[model samples]
Target: MSFRPVIISLVVLALAGLALAFAPTGTTARPDQGDARPFQLRDTEGNLVTDTSLRGQVVLLYFGYTFCPDVCPTELGYVARVLRAMGDDVERTTPLFVTVDPERDTPELLKGYAPLFHPRIRALTGTPEELAAVFKTFGVTARKVPGAGSHYLMDHSSSITVLDRQGRVAATIGSTDTIARSVTTLRDILGKP
Candidate 1:
């Protein structure tokens, strides 16, 4: 049998391993935590949403485009479940969906897409430059992969960056994490239980 498939599988595994290695573990906060930089992007309603404006509220930030076929929808569904499980405690939290493909994911599209996952989930977008800075701040990497003519896909890191009431990087929940685990983490951050 040819080793081409084996080699490809090994390379894919290695890349996934590296991504996990560098990703933040959802655990107890360290003394050096709270390193997330400030960001400003426009919401679906054409209002500017900034880190400062969200102070005193726990933020669950996710980066994905509406055009994403599977991953984005799955992750957002997970977020919606977590929000539902939060019960009344959800009031103190904000879930944000920041699009990586601003060219395709316009305000009108986001306005419809975000509410489908959860009414509380606000979709944000900005200029390429603004998005680049936010990506750098969150250590998120998104690249365009050419597909069929005039079509492209984004290969991006998938993780939910949880910010504390003070707008600090409190924890990170991997896309593969269960809804139960996510609810528990958010509860811990919110000091609920």
Candidate 2:
């Protein structure tokens, strides 16, 4: 019998554990404003980009690997749908896909992968150490675990951290949130009163 199913089950269970580590105990339901952590990483084009450079834009940052089985693809697809529905409102936003598995998710690989979700998506990656730094700053942890033979998967925190026009983390929506809720969260932060 193949161990693939068992390994996939373990990966899902492990991901749940990692996700619980960052789960909030607070009752606060809305995205709160706060200073955004700064980190420099290489974008799809190989140019260095910093959190500070994202000021004046609503930045939606998601940390996951390209190989993520479901959450990554589903969330990206949802974000793409939201962006499409937003029409020109997307111009004021900067959506970033930061890879937790930088060892295999190089700039070139991400360049090809990110746009599949949204045309404006900018994929970011860096050296393993650099990726570690951002993960630390953002209070997320992801680790590779043995999967089926000669393969592995990453278990990472599951949430989308959204920054406001000032580049501060103004809100956080669940990775599994409905598209409407996700859009509302973004609009609340990025929209005019």
Candidate 3:
């Protein structure tokens, strides 16, 4: 009946309003240093990796997708070099590639892409809701923007979050951070001089 349709429309509008109210305002929300937000998402092999799984390891988590045009690859390349320079200390480090565009970057896609950039890096992804929650917890913002043809690209925060063994965010690597700075940051995390 007309009344039923009206009620459904009202309910939908209310839900939309609630969502907007709760959504992060702009990109001002930055992750505070040493805040370790627990998260659970599927890895490249489809295994669920949680905060507990990353315990006792230094984590270099970069949110990106394989299809990213520039920034993702550039940052990842620097990370690879830094990890390689870590020598044996790399054993205690975990580099993660978490996709902002999970719709196209499946576990299988990551399996093939992550290793190509760095042997030490692994990829992760999850349901849209799961991704949204994780992003919110980390103060990351990612939204799909229209691209060429039918394809689309994600506009997301390009910072790399460095988590120490305690899973606390130790450093935030900006998009323009030099490779030397990245290496220095990693060394600092590993207690190297």
lDDT score, candidate 1 = 0.86
Which digits, one per residue and each the tens of the lDDT, describe model 1 over residues 53-92? 9987889999999989899999898889889999998999
| Model 2, global lDDT | 0.80
Provide the TM-score for each candidate, comma-separated: 0.81, 0.79, 0.80
**What's the candidate order when arranged by decreasing TM-score?**
1, 3, 2
Assess the local accuracy of residue 14 in candidate 3 as a C-alpha lDDT between 0 and 100: 100
- Per TM-score, the best of the predicted structures is 1
Tell me the number of clashing residue pairs for each predicted model: 0, 1, 0
Question: What tens-digit string does per-residue lDDT give for candidate 2 at 1-193?
Answer: 5999999999999999989997743323454555567888888777888888888788888888888879999888877887886767799888889998887887778989998888898999887778878877776768789899988998787677888887777777765677788888888888742
Q: Model 2: residues >4 Å from true position, as ranges?
A: 1-32
Task: Kindly report which residue stretches of model 3 are placed more than 4 angstroms away from their true locations once superposed.
Answer: 1-30
> Which model is ahead, 1 or 3, in terms of lDDT?
1
Q: Residue 100, candidate 3: how far off, in angstroms? A: 0.6
RMSD of 3: 8.2
Q: Model 3 clash pairs?
A: none
lDDT of 3: 0.82
